[model samples]
Structures are given as C-alpha cells and as structure tokens.
Target: MFTIHAVDGYIETLYLAVYEDRVLLIDSGCRSDVPRIEEVMKRRLNRPMSQIALAVASHTHPDHAGGAPTLRKRHAIPVAAPKDINQWYAGFSGGLQHKIDIMLGHFVAWTLKYPFEMIYYKKHLLYDHPLKEGDRLPGFEDWQVIETPGHTSHDVVLYHAETQTLYAADVILKVGSGYRPPFPVSMKKEMRESIEKLRHLDVKHLLMAHGGPQQVTDFPAIVDAMLKEIDKGLPPGLKRFRKLERFSPVMKRYYRERRQAKKAS
Candidate 1:
C-alpha cells in the first residue's frame, strides 16, 4: 500500500504503490509541476527514479496525465492510458482555443482556491500505447479496469473486486465536490446513467481522482440522486438558476474566467 501524494495546490493526486523495489506510479502531476513531483517521489520512496516499473493515467485529462511525458523522458518508463483519450489530449493544439482552455482551467482553480499549472507537452510525448477496459496492468493483476464515463467519454475507473475498492476517477467523490466542469460539454443523461452503472457495482471504498478515498454506504441513495437529476433535470439549485435565467450569466462569467486563466498561465 502507498500513500496518495497530493500535487501542489491543484489538489491533484499521484498514486504510488511498490512491489519489492519496483514502484508503480499512477497519474503524474502536470508538466509545470514535475520537479516538485520528482522531489516528492525522492522524499517518499527514498530511492531514485529508476525504481518506477510503470505509470498509468485514468484518462487523458492534463490534470491527471500532464506530467507523464516528463516522467517518461527522465526514466523511460512506459506510460499507459485509456485507449479512448487520445483525441481529447490532442485537442489542445496550439491556438486561441488552447489559451482559452488554459485560462478556463486556471479560473476554475482560482475559484476553488487552487492554482492549476498549465501543461505543455512535446509532440513525441503523446502516449505510445493504449490501455483498454479489462486489460490487465503489467504488475497489478488483481485490479480490473472498468469504463466509467460521464466526465469524459474516455474516462475509466479501476476496480479491485476482491478488495471491493474502486479508484473511481471523476465518476464519484466525497470531497472537493459539487458541480461538474463546463467542458467536454455536459452529458447529464450519460452522467446519470454512468452513476447508475456504478451503483450496481460492489464498491465499498471509493477513491475519486480529485478527492480523498472514502467508504461508500447507501449506494442506492447516491444512485437515486443521479437518476432523479437525469429524469427530472439538473438539481433544484441548478433549476432555480435556470428558471431565473441566472445560470446563463453565471455560466458566462465562469467561461470568461476560464479564458482569463488560460491567458495568465
């Protein structure tokens, strides 16, 4: 077992697990923060970089996988990621939109009192291979990959059926929680369906990518909340905003802030 290392103020986490002297690092932090990540690694592992056996990302989100290239460049470690995330990662091609995306990320971070580090990657640094649901990780045999889309079409969650533990990416959470982000566009129906799918799983300990892991009980209640929103529409709070048409201005402001964050970064 390895402790989750929170990355910078963004509240991102890097997973570290060891087998003998071999270490498995999951989802390195953003590119701008790699030095701090490496420093944290050295301090925690009390060993050099060569000990890392493999690195994996739940999806292609920069917050989750941005540091992969740096880690790979330094250690030549194989970076494994969901097969479906290539396009999303590649969507950040240099342009006005890239800046807008960066700004948007930063704005969200600011509102959350977290600073998002902009991620920059080399062309060759894109993932070299794809990982699919049900594919066994090289060193982690007991863990199974399960597709858990909602936040993103390519999102995935890791399930250890024997342990009844789930690394649920963005599909579930206990902290740093609330509304979903505005991008990848909202798929309220899909999100609700995904939540229903998860409710049926035998999950006990749920680990969200952005929050601390927690024991989940009353799974049906959470599933009901999701389904209710989907069948009826967004929650009351969101609905109130919509009825007053107050949500539009707030959403617009949020978008503007995001654009600004990108420029500042």
Candidate 2:
C-alpha cells in the first residue's frame, strides 16, 4: 500500500505516500538521478505524472535536496525544506559547508571539500516553500517535524506521534557507521548524545535513508550494538615515514579541487 525506494548511490530515501487517487513523493532523488526518480515515481504511483502532489527535502545536502528544482519544474509540485538551510541552497552563505566540515571530521572534510562543492553547485537548485521543525505537511496524518542535528545542522526528522514512525535522515542510520573518521569535531560525543535522545522516544519503526526500516522491538539491542561498536577501535599505532599519515590522497585531491574551484569562482 506504501513504497520507499533508495535513489541513486546516495543511500537516500524517497517515500511514496499513496492514497487512492493521489500520491506524495518525498525527496526527489538528487540532481543526477532526476530521470530515474521520475520514472520510479511514475511506476510506483501508477498515475499521470501530473498527479504527484509535493516534494519535500530533509535538508540542503545535494544528495537530499538536489532534485527539488527538477521535480518542481517538470511535475509542477510545490517543494519545501528546513528553513535554516534554504540560504545555504541559494549560495548566499557557507553554513552548510561549515557544518559538514564539523560533523564529518576535518580530515574527511579535507578529502570531501571539493567533491561536495562540485556536487553542491552542480546538483543543488532552489525551491519556493520553506519547511521548519514542527510544521505539519499536507496528506500525512499529523507528523511532527523534529530538529535533529549532529549529522547535519539543518537535519530534520519526521515523527508520526500515533504510529511512532521516525524518518531519520542521516543523523541516525542503522548502517552502523561512524562519522567518517579522524573523528569529525568529536562527533563521537554528539552521535552518542543524539542516540540517547532517540532511545527515550517512542519509535515503533526506525526508517533511515540508507538501510531498510527496522522494527522497534529490536530498538534496545540495536542501540546497544551501535554504541558498543562506536566505542570499540584498535589502539593508535602506525606512522608514515616517521610521521603519522593523518590524511589520505583522496582527501588531498578533494581539498585541491575545492580550492581550485574556489579560486576560479
């Protein structure tokens, strides 16, 4: 009766809320995969392309917010996202970049800086409406928007109080991964804290962007495993030519590209 498909290589989630004659497509599969996204929408909705109701983005990341403009233009659907990051989408500010750097760890940031810029400039486009925490979207049965940071400053999770269904973007993923290490600004701490907050919430289904949805009955055990692994790691060892290799070549390339791009711009 309902459908959720992973879009492209983003590990992004696009939800289809089907109700009789109408449907709502959430998060338009990043800019690179618009065609595929549209096809998926058509196939799942089983209706004229024009009937798609609204497109909602969780935040400003290109992977999440990239396809909004295309979906809006082609389908004429209204688009909305967290209000705070809309400015970043417009390129007037560097808030999103700053936050990404903080959460992904500086070393990882150094590696991803360029790719992120390219992705941002190439994929990110604007939408007209503004979304904020607590705003209830049309069609959903009173889902409360909750502001969830640590993963991304503008991240927002949607909670259906009654169903206790939580659509946690990247902030909470069952994939059991850490914030791309060298440790992004001590995100280890933030992640732990965030998970703690979620533990107290009454969530029956934990739906993350990448992995499949998890049944709530396993919440405690799953949370414990994540926390355990999050704390486990080999002792610091190894050095590169008498000095530890703190960053990778990929990261160097990322930094170079971002810098060159910045200079050109």
Candidate 3:
C-alpha cells in the first residue's frame, strides 16, 4: 500500500509519498514546516526521518523549496531538482512583471513566516541530484519525471504509471469553480504546451501541490477548459486581483481537503 500525506504550509502544501519502506517527500514548504514534517513522518508513517530517501523540489520558488536545505541537513537526504533550478532561483529571466512577481512572492512568504530560520531562506539550494526529462526517479518504479516548465522555468511533474497519478506541482491549480495558474505566469506558451503534454498521459488522479487529489474522469475536458481560459488571457491587473481574491479561502479549503484525502486514502 502507498500512503500520501499532505501538510499545509504558510502558502503551499508539502506532500509525502510512502511506498513500502521508502518515503519520497515532495516540495518542502517554508522553513517553519520542518518540525511538522518530521512529526508527521514519525507519528503517521511510523518511520524515522532518515527513511525519507528522496526529496524533490517541484520548482525553485521559496514556498516550494525554502525548507529543503534544512531538511537535507537534518536528515541527510538527497534533494533532486531541475538542472536549471539555480537560474530560476537567482531570478527568472523574464519581463519586468515576472521579476516583480518573484520579489513579491518572496516578500509574502517571509512576511507570513516571520522570525523563521534564515538558513531556510537561501536563494539557491545545492541539489544532490539533477533531473531531466524521461529520467526515472530512483526508488520509484514506474514513476517518471516530466519537465513541465512554465509556472517556473524549472517546474516538474511526476507521473506514476502504476497508479496513473500525476504529482502536478504548480503546473495546474484548482481555483473556485475553475482552474488556472496562481499568478504572474512567466511563459504562457510553455504552460499551455505543458498542459497539452499532460493531456496525452493516462492520468486518473491529479495530486496538485496547491489542492487535494482530483479524480480525472475527463482529463482532456479539464485541459480543454483550462486552455480556453488561457486563450482568453486576462490582463495582468485582473489576473492579480482574481488570484488574491481566491488565495486565502481557496487554499484553506484545499488544506483541509488534503488532510481528509490523506486519511481516507
């Protein structure tokens, strides 16, 4: 049996996938989340911290990777990240809005998790393993890494063929009554292409970083709807407003659902 734990953080969710005696942690939240992560591992999985054989950061965003260094140091786990994660960590080489969004994201994370340990806020983490397209992640049979860049230049999604599950980090998000990227998309084109790629996969369940698992009865339909929204692109101001309006409440519900889903699963 495979068990998944979703832990809510300041603005993101951390996922723990336990299969047999191995545990794979996906996306360490803010620095403040380490203690809770360790607790969950011990209490829920009945495993020591050292059993977290692998840790992966879906992207280089602070909400996703801020706690990686601390987790790595504390448990001596190898971190697998995109090869270009360092460049995105430094700062996305996009337009002015993209740069502004990156800065704003950092500010918000720091503000929400103030007095956090400074070591967790490092701009870049030293990845022990660098992943590329088509590579099978070690210790995960039938789980292939898919490079789904767009939300960030180094965003990746993991596809477990055996379970038909897609660990979609931030490539797709579920908002109120609809789905869209959260905010400040750097490359709309690449994002659309990534979604197209997912459309071809045999995905039955979507385990998103920002929401609970969704049964994909009609994934193509979902992708079509999302693409239609992408086709009618919203202006930057409107996009930001919509995102802000949905951020807190929607994420709160997602956190709750994530906990419930983990228990039920």
Best model number under TM-score:
3
Structural RMSD, model 2: 9.7
TM-score of each: 0.72, 0.65, 0.79
Report the alpha-carbon TM-score of model 2 versus the true structure: 0.65
Candidate 3's residue-wise lDDT over 142-251, tens digit each?
67999986566678889888788888888777876677764545457777898899898888988877666788888888789878877778746566544432222223
Instruction: Identify the runs in model 2 with alpha carbons over 4 angstroms from their true place.
Output: 1-11, 87-125, 176-193, 224-265
Model 2 lDDT, full chain set: 0.56
Select the stronger candidate by lDDT from 2 and 3. 3
Top-down lDDT ranking: 3, 1, 2
List CA RMSD, all candidates.
Answer: 8.8, 9.7, 11.4
On lDDT, the candidate that comes out on top is 3
Global fold similarity of model 3 (TM-score): 0.79
Q: What is the lDDT of residue 127 in candidate 3?
A: 81
| Local lDDT at 128 for model 3 | 86
Could you give candidate 1's per-residue lDDT for residues 1-265 as a string of tens digits?
A: 4444444425465566555667766665566667766676688657677877777777655566767888788878787778866544243232333344445446657877864466654422366557776877667766677776655566777777776777766665543344232233234555766777777778776665666556677656756754554556554544432322212222344458768999999
**TM-score-sorted candidate list, best first:** 3, 1, 2
Show model 3 residue runs off by greater than 4 Å. Answer: 91-103, 106-120, 235-265
